[model samples]
Target chain A: MTAPAGQRGRGRPRDPRTDQAILAAALELFTEHGHAGTSIEQIARRAGVGKLTVYRRWGSKDELIAAAVESARGEIPSPGIGDLDGMSYAQISQVIAEALPGSARTLAEPGYRAMLAQVFGSSVTHPGLMAAFWNDHILPRRRTAHLALSRAVDEGVLPPETDIEALIDMTVGAVVYRLLRPEPPDADELLAYLRSVYEQAGMIPRR
Target chain B: MTAPAGQRGRGRPRDPRTDQAILAAALELFTEHGHAGTSIEQIARRAGVGKLTVYRRWGSKDELIAAAVESARGEIPSPGIGDLDGMSYAQISQVIAEALPGSARTLAEPGYRAMLAQVFGSSVTHPGLMAAFWNDHILPRRRTAHLALSRAVDEGVLPPETDIEALIDMTVGAVVYRLLRPEPPDADELLAYLRSVYEQAGMIPRR
Candidate 1:
């Protein structure tokens, strides 16, 4: 409750301290008990903030979830168009190897799984979460992959008639399948395998 | 409570019907509110049985959850070698076509998603579930696909050195990726794409 002089206001101010604490608490509980098992009261208690404070800040459980997700998880940014334009297969696999672990760990969490289940668990009722992930992350990546495939064509690497969407689907889709495998291949192995498969498909220059 | 005629020998033991009722009620509640959201009192009232009955049958919420999943949402049976053998690509696709929809729909349910989130949400902790699915269902299918591919190779349909596992991963994986997609592709289109991809890999006999 120290009133930092620079940010002091006339009314009772919102606390950044409480917000960080809440996000941390939510991550812990979501990791431990799963998103479905966690409750607002539990998060508030873990954060050392009042229940009213949490509710006042985030409103509903879903909103709180969204806020926590915004803080705790971020997607891989779309590769810059220039980066995509000149990217070699080695460069592409490198980006994948770099980002795959955190993506693996986060997706490996029960909290994230529960969120996926909610988005996908009931296609009739809870499709929004899964849909947003595609629009936000999955689809954009495919688009980038497609443009890269076109560049590969221009570079005389792959056959011009190769289905870019299918090619991209096979590459990214394999990454996902590996992630969900019982003994998921390590990030390095996954990247190597991806490189191998894409190379076989003639997306990479033959050494 | 209907007293069993044979139970009179033991001073009329507690009604098995009551026990059944309580189990059913608990299952219903768990499916509605998830593992953590449900309460003993609510289960008892729904079952028209005593709270003590639930406590006696299963000591803790986790135990009750185990019972419900075991009894009601039990394991799915694998498609046998017979189905996978000597089938056209369409028939192969049809097997997945019929089976995946139900699994996909069930995955979409909130409470079910919650359960999965609890189990598979943190996939690192319980690799067992994912393993079970592969061992029980996917591995057998892979073997069948191998048989088909072997036949294709024998018939000079496919390249001799082709890695069958990677191909299987790509073919089957595409369907799985689509199922998990935010905007799940139409089933008919999905099957067509799956067949086309398999044909491209020379898994099926080409004219």
Candidate 2:
């Protein structure tokens, strides 16, 4: 209920570009210092904005983190027709080949580790953080794998009684567990072998 | 080595009590602040010891952190059953129920998550941390589960044709994935259901 007209205050207006910039900076901060260690002042400084601007835009550090992570998604390769699901398990080995090089580098980066620590660690203490990390990252990737498996199941490549949930968890979870290893098994080779097992268990002829 | 050893160079000799106090302080600090956030000054202050005293004894923060964790290694549980050849799946489920509460909580802790991030993340870069983490933590816990499954197979409780590793992994791995959730399921209930599914797969009998 503003009686005064044209009372808006600002220089160059509120650019969504600036918001995106701030979010990007926040992601960088989280990746560097983690959620607990990061501060609004750092995000603002990195974004070339004022601390007041950060506080005004996002009420708390948690909100800022959510916004930052929400952007910069689509970086992860979704499990779809491309290399993961489109081809037969044997053919899908190529996708793993493509990913390993980057996986090696990305996992090595301190920023990446810090980011993972911030998310996986804080998830237990903060439900909101857990929701953000899962919905934003895990669900999309999980859906991709789920779709691939669903296709495999529909094709009768898996036994009608195949434990779909178990099958998915074994392959995916094992990969994550192995990611903690120095020398992980080749994803494609493992996938190729796993698919063979899946087919054999289902009584399907393996190529 | 003919030296003037008149008074051993300083005021109070190194007290075992002080050493224990320092270690305890380090543990409390590490648990509260995580590995990366904790510092030597904080540890010394918490212990009510001089900074020089702590530095002289522990040497480095990493060394101190390692000592603090190693001291608590005795607390991690293990299924004491030497062989499970005669035990039913209920026996196996019982073992999990007894051991999993602490296991779940350990994996859920922020400090442990920080440690995990350091190991897993550095594994891509340093390679040594991976071997250490596996040899120290993951492999040992995993061995108990593996031994139980293998024994079940040997005793004819489980089908001989079972992919023992895969089956065991899939079952426990799913539970672990669920355990990492903010609102974790009841460990007993989950283990019971997993055993039932194993029975359906003929890995274990219905009874």
Off by over 4 Å in 1: A1-18, A70-72, A75-78, A86-126, A135-137, A153-161, A184-207, B1-79, B82-127, B149-161, B185-207
**How much TM-score does chain B earn in each model?**
0.50, 0.57
Task: Kindly report which residue stretches of model 2 are placed more than 4 angstroms away from their true locations once superposed.
Answer: A1-14, A79-114, A125-127, A147-163, A166-172, A181-207, B1-21, B80-133, B148-177, B185-207
> Which residue pairs clash in candidate 2?
none
What is candidate 1's lDDT per residue for A1-207, written digit by digit as tens? 232233333356867888889977875665455456678899999999877777767655555654564554464344545665557655654554455455555555545544443333323233444454456557766765666567767666655555666666666666556665666665456556665555544444333
**Model 2: docking quality category:** acceptable
Per-residue alpha-carbon lDDT of model 1 for B149-177, expressed as tens digits?
A: 66666555565655666667776666555
lDDT for each residue of candidate 2 in B24-54, tens digit (9 for 90 to 100): 8887776555566788889999999877787
List TM-score per model, in order: 0.61, 0.65
Instruction: State the local distance difference test value for candidate 1.
Output: 0.57
In candidate 2 the C-alpha lDDT for residue A88 amounts to 61
Global lDDT of each candidate? 0.57, 0.58
Q: Give the range of the ten consecutive residues with the poorest summed lDDT in model 2 chain A.
A: A1-10
